[model samples]
Target: MDLPRKLLAELLGTALLLAVVIGSGVMAERLSGGNMAVALLANTLATVGGLYVLIELFGPVSGAHFNPAVSAVMAWRGELPRTALPPYVVAQLTGAVLGAWLAHAMFDLPLLQVATRTRSGMGQWIAEGVATFGLLLVILRAPPARVAAMVAAYIGAAYWFTASTSFANPAAVVGRMVSDSFAGIAPASAPGFIVAELIGAAVALLVHPLLSPPRAAGREAASPPSSPARHV
Candidate 1:
């Protein structure tokens, strides 16, 4: 696909994703009556459904890579052109911030607020790493047809399992940093989460090769390997 079209897809897809995540979080918190569990559940469900649709919608055009970590991994693996990485990251980040603003507008909240929710600590960092690792692993290993569902399901589970609620995407960290809603992450804590997520993505890259059988030299030339169509 052309670079412009791919960038547009990434931008729009990431924006909508953040809107769903932050909007659902805000609505859930308002309606959960202080029950954090119930609020998170509502948020998780929205995110899962929204993510699945976005991936399916944008997969053909842009590979549905809404995360810089995922884009970087694809570039490293030669699936995406190395020259396109910077633009893809920029589009995703821009979309993320816009998505946050859109959510705030939809909820009639302040559009320029900052998140004060602290999400720092060793445990949280570790959780971010583990969450990202699992995400990339699933993307790398799952069948192309099942990628969207599996990714959505994994993220939903990660929201409950990870201490940081699985902010595995760097664009998501940036988006949430600008919002003060229930799904937001403080600007102070964004660095750690981003670093952990990148590390986790790297680990998944290394581990993925091990899971697949080594192809014989003659067979490798006969058939090229298939790659996943999308990632969150």
Candidate 2:
């Protein structure tokens, strides 16, 4: 409810998310024995399960917005306070980096390595945009009770459908940039992914209203409270 507690929720939720992503990728790659699809599937399954649990665990406290793009959209929509945006983003980013470190510690890898996996080019950027747009759209439209499950499912689907493996969150991009493992993206590729994600968020914001118009004033009281647009 309070700002400090909300920030803590965001921090913890995001940290756990990154740990799951990076940790699962590491494990998947090792066990998949050079089969990229198998590794990706394992990574997707872990991420989906982890994300669902994290959202349910932290949603009541901080809306469980582990993604900065999601937070920015919430702030713009007046769901999250504008003054709190910076702190929320900072917490998510800090948590992401810490999560990466935690994964490395667990796997006995170098803690300060940079990603050299080159993930760039027009197709990748476009895929990033499409991935983020779908993510935000789902967040904006899904019923509150189903948010966690729907978001996780959408991300899992996106992981296979999108060219970039759906790194839909900028904080994820940052976290993965520092890890040269299966889930990592090269530092040089981070900017394009981040930019595409932001643009996709903006596009989702614009497109959402067209799909789900505001309810009539008389129906406002009957509608559920839309205070926070929760997302992963």
Candidate 3:
């Protein structure tokens, strides 16, 4: 795909992803009547559904990589052109921030706000690492046709299973840090989450070859580089 179109797809996809995440969190919190569990359930369902749809929609254009970690890994793995990595990261980050702002606008909340929900500590950090590791594992291992469902399902489960609620994507961490709501993560906590997620991604990369060696025929059959074929 052309670079401009690819960048636009990444930007729009990431923005929509953030809107789904933050917007759902805000709605769930307001409608759940202070039932944290109920709110979380609602948030998880929305996120999973939105994530799956966005992946299907934009995967054909830019690999539907709304996460910096995913883009970074793909670049390193030779799935993505190294020259495109910087622009992809910039587009994802820009889209993430815009998605946060769009969520606020939709909810009639303040245009910009710093998250106050502090998520930190060793447990949270470890949870982030685990979450990201699993995410990368699924992306690298799943057959191209099944990647979207697997990724969405994994994130949904991670939402409930992980103590840190699986802010596994660095761009997502940045986006969440801007919204002070049920799904927000404090800016102070974002660095740790980012670091932990990167670590997890790195580990996944190292381990993937051992667990699921690439097939010579499969790469040829794989979806185009910009397709949501094997990426999330």
TM-score of each: 0.96, 0.95, 0.93
- Predicted structure 1: lDDT: 0.93
Residue by residue across 13-61, what tens digits does model 3's lDDT show?
A: 9999999999999999999999999999999999999999999999888
Alpha carbon lDDT of residue 159, candidate 1? 97
lDDT of 1 by residue, 1-232 (tens): 4999999999999999999999999999999999999999999999999999999999988999999999999888777888999999999999999999999999999999999999999999999999999999999888788999999999999999999999899999999999999999999999999999999999999998777767743463366544425454
lDDT of each: 0.93, 0.93, 0.91
> Which candidate would rank higher by lDDT, 1 or 3?
1
Which ranges in model 1 have alpha carbons more than 4 Å from their true place?
Answer: 216-232
Task: Tell me which residue pairs clash in candidate 3.
Answer: 59-228, 63-226
lDDT of 2 by residue, 10-43 (tens): 9999999999999999999999999999999999
Regions of candidate 2 where Cα sits further than 4 Å from its true position: 213-225, 229-232
Evaluated with TM-score, which candidate comes out highest? Answer: 1
User: Which model, 2 or 3, shows the larger TM-score?
Assistant: 2
